[model samples]
Target: MRPFNFEKVNSGAEASAAKSQNKQFVAGGTNLVDLMKKNITQPDILIDITKALSNTIEHQNKGVTIGAMASNTKVATDKKILRDFPLLAKAILAGASPQIRNMASSAGNLLQRTRCPYFYDVTMPCNKRKPNSGCSAIEGENRMSAVAGYNNQCVAVHPSDFCVGLSA
Candidate 1:
């Protein structure tokens, strides 16, 4: 990964205030770190919001409120979620391995990058990774790519099964 300054913020407001063109808010670094290592993202400042964000799973009126920083494992194993949203819990468990679930955050999962191979390879051209760079996935192997909502610019599919479950 490129050399960058890390800042730990204690609140969303502070994170927002610190965010700028060269800064990014990071909760779980699972996805962001990978992208950075691949040179897909090079933020000058990384604002860590994990400590500042709530990790609680609150049961609201006929629904649940999962904190942005709550890990997938926490959400899957939470008594309230397991009891009230069994399918959701199952879906999350089915998505990633146990170790990843323990470190991956709910919000971070939703915002994770596409699983397109080209997107992660700095040597390959990808529109999503670099606008107007030309899409290499279009003519390459794309069995896992999207069939809908795809255009010339990008055909990458969202790589989160948790997101699919949440949407359902």
Candidate 2:
């Protein structure tokens, strides 16, 4: 991973205020860390938002509020979540491993990047990684590419089971 400056903030406003030219907000560091390791992303600044965000699952009159920093495991295992959003619970439980679910935040899951092989492989051509570089998945191996709402430029899809559950 490339060397970068780090900052820890205590609120969403603080995180937003600290955003630099090439800054990324990191909470669980689940997806972002892997991308960083692969050199897929090279942010100049990493704002640690773990402390700034709430992890609690709050019960409200209309519905439950899940904190952006709430872990997938916490959302999956929460009494109210399990009772109210079983599909979401199941989706979260089905993703990654126990350790990953324990660290993957709900907001991070929603904001996670594509799982396209072309996008991950730095040596490969990917429009998402580099605009107008050409999309390898269009003519190359595309088993994991999107089935709908795709163009010639890209066929990448966001691989998040939690987001699918959330949609329903």
Candidate 3:
């Protein structure tokens, strides 16, 4: 793993300022840290957004305005979220394991990458992980690939059970 510089940001503006061509937004780092360790993601600087974003879950007239940094566990178990959106709660439960849910943020979960094998293998060519690279799985083993919403470029499925529940 590469030893990279870390910057503690206090606000979105600070985060934006700290960001660079080689910098990445480090929120939960549940996925980023692991990817970095694997050298799949090489960020020169990680702008920590955990402290910057408000983690409060507030009730609004329409619904609830969940903060960007609010953890999945909090969102899944929130009384208002569970009661008003049972499907969302169940979907969150069905998605990631308990430990991941505790640390992963709702915003991060919503921005998760596809669970495609090609995307995982650094050697294989994947368009989602690397834009314009021809998809190798277009004719390869694709029992898990998307069929309904797939395009000619990529057949990767957005793996988000909570997203599906939220949409429903």
Candidate 4:
């Protein structure tokens, strides 16, 4: 991993102001850290927003408003979520292993990248990983590729158990 500057912001406005072309907001660091290690992303600055963002699960009149920084495990086990949205809880629990869910944030889970093998391989050409580099999964092994709603740019399927539940 390349050296980078890190800052912990205390508010959304601060985080937004700190944003730049070479900077990225990090919450749980689940996806961003992995991408950085893989060289798929190389931000010069990382603004830590885990504390800046809300982590509470709010009970609304019609539904629940889950904070972006709330961990997947927190959402899955929240009393209101389990009582009001049991399916969502079940879906999140079904998606990632217990350890991952405990570390992954709700917002981070929603923004996760594709799980395509080509995307993870820096040596392989992947349009999603590097635009216009060409999609390696097209002609290569594509069992996990999308059946529909795919273009030449990408064919990987979204792999988030929590996302699936939220969508439903």
Candidate 5:
């Protein structure tokens, strides 16, 4: 693990101003922190957005407004989100096992790294991990690779079955 600087800012303005060249907004570091520890992600500044401006599910106009920081479990279990936006609910349910969904957020889920085993191991050469690294999954264990919308470079399938169901 590498030694890095850490601090907490109170307001949105302060947080935005604190953004450095390598600074990243971290909300529910369920994924980012792990990558950092694994030496996959290295950031100079980590602005924790666990509690900042907006972090709640709201219904103001016609449709629903899903805050980036709202927990996936809450959205998956919320009557309103489930009833109105089953797509969102289904997506959440299909993601990150039950434990991860409980701690992950919608925005974070959208940005979660690929589940390709090759990608997980930093030592392995993966196009997604290192652009033009020459895809290994193409000729490797492709059963777990994509069943649709996959090309030669990367054949890894998206693990989110919920995303598929939610689209319908």
Candidate 6:
């Protein structure tokens, strides 16, 4: 990962105001850090939003409000979440491992990138990795490729169990 400026904000508003081109908001750094290490994404600035966001799960009149910084483990084990959205809880528990789920933030999980092999390989031509480059997964191994909501430009599938559960 290349050297980047690090800024810590104390609120969501501050984090939003700090946004700029080639800047990434990092809470748990589960996805962003990995992408940085692989050179998939190189941001010139990293806005640490962990302290700037709420990590608690608040119950609301209709349902619940899950903080963006809330960890997967917190959401999966929260009594209200388990009672109101058991499927969501189960899905969160089913993802990654205990350690990863503990560190992966709710927003990070929701914003995860596709797990397509071609997208990870820099040498491979992937439209998702580099737009207009061509999608290698379209003609290559595509067992996990998208069956719906896919165009000719890309066929990659998001690998987030929590997202699938939320959709259902």
- Taken over the whole model, the C-alpha lDDT of each candidate is 0.86, 0.88, 0.83, 0.88, 0.74, 0.87
- lDDT by residue (15-83, candidate 4, tens digit) is 989999999988888788989998889999999999888999999799888899999999999988999
User: TM-score of each candidate?
Assistant: 0.91, 0.93, 0.90, 0.92, 0.82, 0.93
Model 3 lDDT tens row, 1-168: 899998899998988888889999888878788778868888898888999888899987767888889998998899988888888889988888899888888778788767566777778888887899878788779734886788888888887766877788
* CA deviation > 4 Å runs, candidate 1: none
- Tens-digit lDDT track for model 5 on 91-149? 67865687887777777866677757677778777888789987777777753478778
Query: Runs in model 2 with CA error above 4 Å?
Result: none
Residue 77, model 3, lDDT: 93
Stronger candidate by lDDT (1 vs 6): 6
- The true-versus-predicted C-alpha distance at residue 74 of model 5, in Å, is 1.2
Candidate 6, 1-168: lDDT as tens digits = 789999999998898899999898998888789889889999999999999988989998778888989999999999988988999999999888999999999989998887687887889998888889988888898844788888777888887777977987
Residue runs of model 4 more than 4 Å from their true location after superposition: none
lDDT of 2 by residue, 7-26 (tens): 99998899889987899999
Candidates in order: C-alpha RMSD to true structure: 1.6, 1.5, 1.8, 1.5, 2.6, 1.5
Tell me how many residue pairs clash in candidate 1.
0
**Whole-structure CA lDDT of model 6:** 0.87
Assess candidate 3 and give its TM-score to the true structure: 0.90
Query: What's the residue-level lDDT of 102 in candidate 6?
Result: 92
